[model samples]
Each structure stands twice: as structure tokens, then as C-alpha cells.
Target: MSEPAMSEVVANLNLVRERIAEAAVRSGRAPDAVRLVLVTKTVEPSRILEAVRAGQADLGENKVQEGGRKADALAGEPVRWSMIGHLQSNKVKDVLRFADEVQSLDRRSLATALDKRLQSVGRGLDVLVQVNTSGEASKFGLTPEDVPAFLKDLAAFETLRPKGFMTLATFTPDETEVRRCFRLLRDIRDRARQDAPQGDTLTDLSMGMSGDYQWAIEEGATVVRVGQAVFGPRPLPDSHYWPGAAGTA
Candidate 1:
């Protein structure tokens, strides 16, 4: 499987957490405010269990089938699975079965599908409305201007609890552009919160990946989706992480 040893995973996790703490303090916020959702897109269940036992309980997978399989394999483990990929309507039931949160609630069709299924089950799911803050054709999310109204629309879905926003910054090495994208999502969140309903719903900013997470934390990201640094590198390209880029992938 080529994954790291359990001890290596623990050391990697500690390094990541230490960096997170440093970033949070540098940004004038407590490290506890930021939660890390370790991305395990292709990571094996046994390796994932190693991390869970090491005290990193929240895990994120970029595909429904993969996450469901891991959830089955890691059954009875103290892990919380988050559906962090572009979820189609047909996969709603499976995701609801395996995921504790949906981080890519970017479109109304998906929301309608989720709301319908959750209503049938009489259950609720915490969701983060995704924003394509980078304006890339290869990402899935509402536009910056469209997010406030979308957050307002979420109120209609009684079973879908809107917790905050998630986004993919531009896949570039340009620090300025990358940080700009993070800053924009923060601005959108702030503006959305001016409305009482959205204000109550918007509390988290789930932006940044392994490379850009520190900048995201500096700009008020409450949840950072990290993978490569904690689990070694993956074969996928940075663009592959965007839900909208799956067709070409």
C-alpha cells in the first residue's frame, strides 16, 4: 500500500498540528478554533485506522464509494467521515449513510436531493456551501456573489444544517492569488452573515489544502482540509482535488 508506518503517521500528524498551532497564533486566533479534516482519498483503511488511533478522528474522503468502503472497513472506529468531493444526486443515500458532514454542497440540485433524502429519513446533516472562490472552470462551488443568496436558500432545507463555507483556491504557486482567494471567501462569509439567518449559519471557513493551509488559517479559515503533508504525497494533481475537474480526470 506504500503508506507510512503508524509511528511515521503520528510524527507527521504532530508536525502538521504544530504548524497549525503556529499559524493560528500568528493570525491572532487560538489553535483550537481550527479543525483539521485529514483527506484520505485513496489511503487504505488500515492506515486510516492508524491515524484515528493517533487522535486525528476527523477524516475526509473525496469520493462517496471510497468513503463508504472505508467507513465499512473502519466500522466501530472513532472516526467521523466527511464527504469532501463533488457528490451527485444519485449518491445522496450512500453519502448520508457514511458521511457525518457534506463539504461540497455547491448546487441547488444537490441540496434538493439531500434535503429530500434526509426528509424521508427524518434526519439532518451538517453542510458547508462550497464557493469557487478562484473563478476556475475546474472547481465546483457557487460564485462569490451567488453565495449569500444560496446561504439564504439553505434555510428552506430544514434537514440540511448550514454550518459555513468551503472552497478551493486557485491551483497556483502565486502566493498573492492563492491568499486572495482565501480572503475572498472570508469576505463572502462576512457579508453573508450580515443577514440574520445566514449570520447564524455561517461560522466556519473550510478553505486551503496541505500547501496553502497556513495562509488560509491566517485569513480566518476555521477548517483546513489537509492531506499530502500528513499522508505523504498522492498521485493526483492539485487540480484533481477540485470536484468540478472529475470529468477530465
Candidate 2:
């Protein structure tokens, strides 16, 4: 696939931003309240830089090595990097080098790895606990039932700040199924707040993708990972971007 034109990236960004605004307004929330994190997996560094120069503040990359390369290429640019795919303990070092946040923090072991790495550098990281709202075996996240206890356990990792929850709604055309998955994440967040060390900190919901961001906004998503709508469809197979074939934004 051709790299997205600079003009195309800018134009698509405008359209996506407008859609986000309309979605937020329909949900009775200010447009700025919802944050857009452009998922840039498989996009080359130059084109990714194009989007960054076009005013995209947050960018999500699925792989640590790829993110690190982009981070190196775009060093000094004003962009926040996020690891939005399944994280491994071994990759924590590379991930910490670039990611401002880890949106797929699902396991205690991974949390421990991240905390240890951050402590070495004397920096703290913002993270969202990933929840398998769709109940799919292929997805990587804490089960909804396990989330409350998990949030409580996060207090042990001082370098890790719990920002909220992230989830990938079921990849289907049915809006009901998609919205249900999103609402479940919100509901779980609501219930887990009482068990959290700081309830106010769990203020963001990282749900939604290119296909169903509006539904996610209506269901209370403060963070949306968008890709195809902004960068155009990725040319590779699902496994190419998301190992194990997890759905992309």
C-alpha cells in the first residue's frame, strides 16, 4: 500500500476529529474530553511523522521494536507514544524507552516488569488495565471479574499509575454486540472504582476503534484508538500487525 499522502493524513484527521466531536456531543460530553490516540502499527516512520506534524498528539504502536524505531526517527517531535498491544515482560525494556503509557497492561507479571524498569530510570508511567470485555479467547486482558482485585493490587507498583481501562470490543458489524462490550468495560470501571486506591484516577476508558468509536463515545470512552479511518487500511494480514490476530483500530 502506498504511504498516506501528507494532505490525506491531514484531511482524514480533520474528518476523524469532527466525527469524534459529534460523538462526544451526542453523549453530552465536551469534545475535548475524549482523547484520540492514532494507532500507527505497520505505518512507516516518515508517514507516521506526517501525522505527528499534522497535529496528532498521541500515537499507539503495537510492537515494541517498531515503536522504538519510530521513536528514534521522530526524536524531539512533540508526540506521546503508547503501547496498545499485548505486552511481554521481556519487551518491557524497549517499551519503556518510548511509550508514555501502556494501554494493554493486563497481568501482574507485566506490571512488575514495567514497574522495575521504570524505577531504574526514575520515571513513572501511566497505564490502563486491559479487560477482555468481549470474553474472546484470543483477546489479552484481565477478565472482568478479575479487574477489581487487579486494580487494588496495582498499589504495590508505585511507579505504575492506574489511569483507567482499555478494551477491544468484539469485531463484528452488529452495533449491539460492539456497544455491549464497550458498556461492560465502563460498568466494570464503575464497579472497580470503589476498590481502587484512588477512585478519581480511574477516569478514562480506552475503548473503541476506527469502526465503532461513536458507539464507544456514547458508552463512555475517554480514549479511542483509531487507525484505518485516519491512516487508511493496513496492507498486511491481521497477524502481521497484531500477533495472535487481535483486532486493530
Candidate 3:
């Protein structure tokens, strides 16, 4: 597929930003309260560079290898890489090579692996715990009931900082259901904060995407991972990346 023209990409980005601003205002939050992480899963490097030139520095990727490649290629740029997809323990090292943050941390084992890897580099990483608020069997995240214990366990990993929580809402046209998922995530974040360690700063709620980011912001999202709205639609089907996303797109 041909790459989108830079002008077109910029225009789309402005539109998305406008929506974000509107959402923030509606929620009585400052426009800067939410951060936009452009998801570049299957997008070409050249197009991503265009976005960088256009002033989008935060980029998100679903796969470690793919994100690693982009990070290497754009090494000198002022971009910050974020891992916003389910991560495997074996890929922790690769992810650390470029990712400034990981927004999909779920289980204790993954945290253990990440902490070990960070220890090797003498560095630390910001992470958001992924929660399966929608209750989708195919989704990878800690169940709502399991998040408190997971958050407590994460305190042991000094190298991994808990930044808050991340979640994927149910993929459906029904606005009520989608908002419910976002609300649940926000509630989880609120509850987790009570028992979180004094040093563990849980502040970010990474929710929403191309389809429902505005609703997410309204429901208290501090970070929104957007793709199609800014970069144009991916050539592949959404189901290829997310099981129930095809119909929503």
C-alpha cells in the first residue's frame, strides 16, 4: 500500500488532537492532562519519520521485534518508544533496548523478567499493568480481581516502576459497553492506588484507541494509544491484531 502523504497525516493528527482536547474539556480536565501515543504497529518507517517530523515523539508498537527495528532506525531522533501490546518474557530484553515504557505488564512472571533485565542494564522502566476489564478470553491482562495482588507484587521489582494501569475496552458499536470497560479500568486504578506502595507512583491510565479514545478520556484516561485516526487505516484487518476489533473498525 502507498504511504499517506505527510500533509494528510498531519491533518489526521490535528483532527485526533482536536477530539482529544474536546474530550478533556468535557471531562473538566486540562487538554494536556492526556498524552497521545501514536501506535505504529504495521506502519512503514518512512511514514513514521514523517510523523516524527510533524512533532509526534511518542510512538507505540505491539511487537518487540517490529518496535525494536523502528527504534534502531530512528535512534537519533527525539522519539520515545512504548510497548502497548501483550509482551512475552523471552522478548523482555529486546523491548528494553528501545522501549521507554511498557503499558501491557500483567503477571508477576513478566515483571520478574523485566526487573532482571533492567537490573542487567542498571536501569529502570515505567510500566502500566494491563487489566482485562472486558473479560475477553482472548485478551492478555490480569483479571480485575487479580490486579491488587499484582500491584503489591510489583513493588518488589525495584527496577520496574508502576505507572498505573492499561486496558482494552470491549470491541463493539454499543457505546455503553465500551464506556463500561473504560470506567472499570479507571475504578481499578483508583482502588489499586490505595494499597500501592509509597514509592510506587500509579498515575497513568493507558486506555482507549483509534475507535474510542474520546470516551476513554472522558472516563479518566491519562494516556491514549491511537493508530488509524492519526496514521490512516492499516492494510491488514484489525482482527489480525485484536480478535474482536474487526467489526468495530
Which candidate has the top score in TM-score? 2
> Distance from true position, residue 44, model 2, in Å?
1.5
lDDT tens digits by residue: candidate 1, 116-190 = 999999999999998988887767889888876777778888998888899888877888998999999898888
Sort the candidates on lDDT, descending order.
2, 3, 1
Model 2 segments more than 4 A misplaced: 1-6
Return whichever of 2 and 3 wins on TM-score: 2
Residue 192 in candidate 3, Cα distance off native in Å: 1.4
Candidates 2 and 3, the one with greater lDDT: 2
Assess each prediction's global lDDT (C-alpha) against the native.
Answer: 0.85, 0.89, 0.86
User: Roughly what TM-score does model 2 have, to 2 decimal places?
Assistant: 0.95
Using lDDT as the measure, the top candidate is 2
Cand. 1 Cα-lDDT = 0.85
> What lDDT, from 0 to 1, does candidate 2 have?
0.89
lDDT of 1 at 96: 94
Candidate 1 at 168: error in angstroms? 0.6
Q: Which whole-number lDDT from 0 to 100 does residue 172 have in model 3?
A: 86
RMSD of each: 3.7, 3.3, 3.5
Q: Which 10 consecutive positions of candidate 2 have the poorest summed lDDT?
A: 239-248
